[model samples]
Target: MIAGGERTLNVVCVKWGDKYPAYYVNRLYSGVTRYLDRPFSFHCFTDNGDDIDPRVRLHDLPVEPFESELQAAMQRKGRKGAWRKISLFRPGLGGMEGQILGFDLDVVITGRLEPLVDAAPDKVAMRHEWRYEWKGQPGGHGSVFVFDPALHRYLYNDFAADPVGSVERNKGSEQYYTSMSAFRRGQLHYLPGSMVCSFKYDAARIPPLNLMMEPRLPLDCRVMCFHGSPKMEEAVEGFEAGLLRSTRPASWLKRHWRV
Candidate 1:
């Protein structure tokens, strides 16, 4: 929906350093292209673009004066997850006119993304993972969120106002700020929990009697988000330990990426 054209959904991911290797991004790109039926463009915003696949549009990470200061703070001991705050609200992001879906690099796509793009046009849509809800109060997980660039400028503006304080107030958590900002604007919509199931909570917690049960494909779920401990690496580990069944790498991914 760039200015005056049909609204094609746009999906984006950000990559920096060696924390997540290029194969992960490439595999995600393959999954989106294979599963999504709607017209869309997949892009990766990254600091290191050399090793990324050519099929994914590589945009340089937006640079600003405060970025260096943020980087220094991120280097301090016990600063894991602090970088998420700065990366999620980077300046000049989502300038494109269509709906933008952002995914964390650690996730593995299991279904179509069109449902997310087709969600309500005005509200910012995100998975309502149970962990974020406090004592029945509503909240959202920002690991997978859809927003329109023209509408959510305040997301970055508020962060820019007090970068350091903003990080501290939200404890450097992107989901907290995203939910708070959306709530303030009265433009937040929660997607069903089944759509973004946590592998650790949903998949791994089934009793031993149900250990052989096949994983059910959620009817309303269009995206499966991997947040926290049961990440791709952990899934691999669980399979190795016989606590989980191994899944073949997505066929589309194998066809495109030999590894």
Candidate 2:
């Protein structure tokens, strides 16, 4: 919906504080450019734009109108920017009027993104949560998601009215609140699991299996999500920690995380 009939696919990612360097944004832009053939804009919503690539459209991180639900959850966990991602729900985010694809800095794009985004064009598009709950209510993952800023404005308005209540009801997960809010309105649909594989379940190897095979990428996966680690860097560096420990090398991750 611009001049000359050109389609705009606004790919957006957010960065705050020092968790991810600005270079991560640049790499994301590079990956997007490699796979997406259409005319598009890659935006970095960040607190500090000093080190980011000039090609990336840097916009200051949008502010929340009130206390965010994620902030309340983070107060006990001692983490910041947990709710910063939700700020993108603001109408016409960064003044870009089009469908938006939100990505976490840690994600690696593996294939063309158009199919999934176009699949549920009239609704919110997202991947399923950490697990596939066949018998229970559905949940969404925030690592990669798509929505229309102008149409899905209710998610922001309702949450702003009662951030605490929203947090408590969704069990303090912004992902849950985000998807459920749209789901109720019949405006949320999930991308196929084969298209958005998780590093932990799909790629990482267990002790006995680490010797059997290396991490395998799904043939149809468009994006690889590194939820709850090892993170993209950890996977690239070949290490795992805590309960999800695995020392097996993730050479494939290192190869894809950048290009």
Candidate 3:
């Protein structure tokens, strides 16, 4: 529990390799510092902490115990699975206990985050994928998630026993697999669509009209995630991929993504 009536919001993110620079974490921390009113702790599970801001706590990346299983799973899918995020379920991360809010490094924190921390205080909360299909299957986008690490340790244990089996059960989607764990315990819930949304699905407007006006922010969306092309960094500097492009001068990205 956090002191002084404020909730202890533990916001975490992960990174490995150099795909994204350290400033992504820095800017995200800066955004959290700017918008969140409650006392919060920021953590980054990363391979290297070199250009990261001093305010953000860093931890070494978690090692996968089932490397052979991981490789087999990836080979079966013909693509890499984001099974690494499964590590978040490991016990006692950063010694936090109340609420664990996970943010992908490529997301832009746009507004107050007290809602994500407060809305479903005792459940595993995350965004629902609007564009995917799986019969009787719930698609949980992995960009943002909230749960207690200690309470969810079984996820890591089960995966340790058979990583490929776990992936196969969820069609190789780590997000869905994670949600299934929460669902099994009757603690699965989706963050309000307005609380966590996507940049590509919600923000990327169809263009010549895009030439005239900027993409309007989603109603009450606190964070917008950039899952694919035109990452936060690319969006900040004005993104253009083939014919699909957000017009030049992406000032909105600079406002939130840059702090």
Sliding window of 10 residues with minimal summed lDDT for model 2: 73-82
The Cα local distance difference test for each model comes to 0.64, 0.78, 0.77
Worst ten-residue run, lDDT, model 3? 130-139
Best by TM-score: 2
Which residue pairs in candidate 3 have backbone atoms (N, alpha carbon, C) closer than 3 angstroms, thus clashing?
Answer: none
lDDT at residue 167 of model 3 (Cα atoms): 80
Model 3 lDDT tens row, 20-68? 8898899989988988887778989999999899888898887677877
Q: What is the lDDT of residue 18 in candidate 2?
A: 94
Cα lDDT tens digits for candidate 2, 1-259: 5589755888999888898887778878888888777778888888899978888898987767674544655676533335777778887778788788889888888888878778888788888786645546687878889888788889888878887677777767788888889889888898888898888887877666654466677889899987776777777766645434664677776666673
Q: Specify the highest-lDDT model's number.
A: 2
Q: Give the TM-score of candidate 1.
A: 0.80
Q: How do the residues 21-117 of candidate 1 rate in per-residue lDDT, one tens digit apiece?
A: 8888887887778768877777887878876788788887767556766666556554445244344454345454557787887666666666666
Candidate 1: segments with Cα more than 4 A from true spot: 1-4, 72-95, 207-219, 233-259
In lDDT terms, how accurate is model 1? 0.64
